[model samples]
Target: MEFKPVTHVLFDMDGLILNTEDLYTVAFQNIVSQYGKDYTFELKLKLMGSQAHETAKIVVSHLDLPVTPEEFIAQTSKEFEKIFPDTEVLPGARCLIEHLSKHNVPIGLATSSSRESYELKVNKRHKELFSLFPYKTMGSSDSEVKRGKPYPDIFLVAASRFPDKPKPEQCLVFEDAVNGVKAARAAGMQVVMVPDPRVDESLRTEATLVLKSLEDFKPELFGLPPYDD
Candidate 1:
């Protein structure tokens, strides 16, 4: 397949870089279980890449839980405080980031997590690896991002922050969510999706490229420097 060359890259955090999606499942299950509800994978598919408050609302409404979205967030926040620090970096994520930084390619993080949530997940264990991003657009916290995934705001904002302010077409996005792929495409950027195995094949069609894991990505295909190995 022919791939477009890109000058800059944007990455999604939760499931793409960190293994926090599983952690979030654990946390959400803990909260919903209290209300005698189970957090289903079908529901998780819809929540991926949404902002914290948006996720809370969806969970509350979908499960018919009595709690308000704010209450659900508070409940989940407590659960997250316990497990988020333990988030592991996903395979090939470190190598890819380091390679991009080493090649002097402009890179930024675009996550639906708020700054506080980002700190919780990154500051403890993955600080050094995440610090490689010159800037990160936290969709829940960034004033410029009026909307989260499924909307182009976050990716557009991330690209604008690049020193050269790259055009949307000049940017490539790495994502692990269907909503994120839509967002990147809506922004006119190419996206490489690394989706969970449970996600339907039809959902993968919108992405410019689909791979099982970041380990499968070949940077050379996108005009980025190839690994020395």
Candidate 2:
């Protein structure tokens, strides 16, 4: 929690900044259900923030279903599109992004979500602090970063976005999953995990600061804002 001399704010989209985790759950279940496999809420919680490839393997194993990985991914992805219209930003997420944008910190988004999906969804808000631009970022499919969280590919991509811009230690990452925390940490960045209440306590251990929610987040705690603010 102490490492708040932040020059950059890196974010994870699905669960941390947006309420798309449950949507993913619903979509995934619907997709798997069509194939007669059981995909539950608990399964989605276990699989959030992961790459489609990583998730398909688990889905196949858990449901005891037999299918090619590529087939499962394609089917689930089609289901996600049907559900993205129902997604919404999380509480305090808009204000947090607005506040940071007003401060002009270089911000980047690191997500396993495809660029097309991010553009369709995140661009609708226009509150995103950075794109793959002069500000810097890396969308999925742009890089060969094969592994997802618990593997640092995404966070590494985020930190490297503005390579000549800010140092990794000077960046702050907001995450809601243990795998995301592990990703940020492995990227040599400090992480504050604002986990969904449904995620268990064991996952919170990997975070540098495990707060209740972004509502409880105070820039003052990191000495970024004056006490009155």
Candidate 3:
């Protein structure tokens, strides 16, 4: 399918840019298994792209765990603190970001992570890479974002922050979550989903394009400069 020319791009931070999904899985399994509950892929999909408290609530309710959302959040937050810093850039993520930046593309981050969590995940070693983004909208912390993914608030907010105030249709989003694909569509933007292999193929239909990895992305397809190779 052909895509409209895009003037700006917005990215999801967690599973798309960094390998935090694996760390999240380990943390979730460790907590849920303590209560004799299993963390299923179906449940993981539902929780993907949700904010911190929302994720905790889903885990507790879906797993029928005997804990308040607050308690679940506290436990998971501790585990995240231990794991998030260890995250590495996902394959081709750096190349794509640098390619876009080198071409003077307007790029921004739109994440469900709180500002604190985002920093913890990136500040130590990936600061230089993230600095390429002119702006970022952290749904958990940005007051202007009234709702998280599956809702269009965060992506819309990110687009509005661009100095050019590009129309939603002129922005392209790269996401790795089902909810994020929905959000981008609701925002009237084109989305390229780089979902995990375990994600069901049927769920990919909503995205303008779905690829196995950012390594498979061709910028020229989106009207952006092609990679030098």
Candidate 4:
């Protein structure tokens, strides 16, 4: 594929930067199992990159669980409190962020997680690494992001916040979900997807590039500085 050079970069949080998807599965399963329902992978694929309330609604509807979205969120929020603090950065995440920061490349975070959730996952464990981003757009909490993943709002908003206000084509997105890749493409940005191994091959066709892990990414391919090591 022919690639365009980009001047700015946006990143998705959750399964992309942090290993929180498994933790979320554990939390969601704890709730649905109480109602004799299972949280299946097919269902999880739909929930990935959705807003908090959106996710709760999908879970409640898909599993036919007798709980309001608000109620489900309350239950899962409690579960998150116990498990989120243990969130860990994914492989090559820190190295890539630091390399970009060191080279003065413009970067920002564009995540479907609410600000409160982001803090829980990163504040204590990965503050320095995350702080490298000049700004972040938390879709579930940011009023400016009127829509979640599969929509262009979050990535567009993230790019707009950059000091230079780069155009969508001038931005590159790093994501791990099909919805997120769709969002980036909708925003007219090139995206590099490092999806979970369990993600189906058919779902990866839309990304500008797809890799097994962030460690497999070649920044030079996108006009970003290469890692010194």
Candidate 5:
């Protein structure tokens, strides 16, 4: 299949470009374990790609936590920060970002992750690579956006950042989770689904293209040569 120009590229940070989801799962398990709530792997499958704050609400509801959503979010953020630095990108992430940056491709990060969590988790070394992207959008952009994943607010915010440029169809989203893909699709952006099969089987039916990993991401898909030799 022929890929388009891909003038703008929006990436989902946590699962797609970064390997932080494992940290989230472990931290969540820690939280639930404290309450004697068994958050099984199967249970975790339901929360992948969800916003951290929203995920906290779901977990609190599932486990019957005696805490408010605000408190749950605060606790989750604290714990997530403790484990986030250990999370880096999956294979080919560095190379792909570097290559895309070299060609002057417009890249933006659209994440449901909070700015504080993102800074603590994705700062420093990541900046060397992500700095070239020149755009950032987070879920905090809208207050009415309550649910994550199924909601398109984050992607819409990211797309709107390019107001002077291409239409929604001109921008493409790279997402690994089913919900992230759903959000991108809802925003009317062309989506390239990078499914983490271990976490997302349902996403296959919703994506424009499915790839095993970013290892298969080619610069030519955006009409550019492979960078870094």
Candidate 6:
């Protein structure tokens, strides 16, 4: 299928831009293990692109945990505080962001994280790289984003924040979750998925392109300028 020339780009955080997924896995395991629950990839995928409360609720319900959502949030927040500061940017994340910024391409970040969580995960280690995105739409905090991933609210709101307000067809999204890929397509945008290796191959069919890492992304295929190096 042919894609329109993409003039703008949107990015998802967490697994897509940062190496915080493992941190979350450890946090969830630490919490759920008390209840004799194993934190599995299937559960992780369900929580991947969900909003904070939604994720908490899903975990609580799925595992039949005795804790309330509020308790889960508080516990997870504490765990994240201990580790999110150590969060690292994924390979090629800085390179791709800088490359697009240098070429004057409009770029934005649409993350399911709340402003509080986003700050803890990125502000401390990658402030310079994060600042490159003029539009940082924190879905869990944005009043305009009524729904999380698997829904088009965040991406649509993110696209609207662009200075020139590019159409969904003129924008490309980079996501790392099944729900995120579905959301981007629902918003009428093409999405490149840099998914975890363990994600089911069948789930990958919806992405416009799937790569093992951002390092494998070829900007010129979407009409963006190629890397000079």
lDDT of candidate 3 over 89-125, digit per residue (tens): 9998999999999999999999999998899899888
Span of 10 residues, lowest total lDDT, candidate 4: 122-131
lDDT per residue for candidate 4 within 1-229, as digits (tens), equals 9899998989998998999999999999998999999998899999899999999999999888898999999999999999999998899888888989999999899999998999999888888888899899999999999988999999999999998889999999999999999999999999999998999999999999999989888999988888897
Clashes of each: 0, 0, 0, 0, 0, 0
**Residue runs of model 3 more than 4 Å from their true location after superposition:** none
- Give the TM-score of each candidate: 0.98, 0.86, 0.97, 0.98, 0.87, 0.98
RMSD of each: 0.8, 2.8, 1.0, 0.7, 2.5, 0.9
Compute the lDDT of residue 211 as modeled in candidate 3: 92
lDDT of each: 0.94, 0.72, 0.92, 0.92, 0.74, 0.94
Clash list (residue pairs), candidate 3? none
| Per-residue lDDT of candidate 6, residues 93-139 (tens digit) | 88999999999999999999999999999778789889999999999
Number of clashes in model 1? Answer: 0
**Which digits, one per residue and each the tens of the lDDT, describe model 1 over residues 38-145?**
999999999999988889899999999999999998988899899999899999999999999999999999999999999999999999999899989999989899
Identify the runs in model 5 with alpha carbons over 4 angstroms from their true place: 141-147, 200-202, 222-229
Q: Which residue pairs show collisions in model 5?
A: none
Question: By summed lDDT, which 10 consecutive residues of candidate 3 come out lowest?
Answer: 54-63
Quote model 6's TM-score: 0.98
State in Å the error of residue 65, model 6: 0.5
Candidate 2 global CA lDDT score? 0.72
After TM-score superposition, what is the CA distance of residue 178 in candidate 1 from its true location, in Å? 0.6
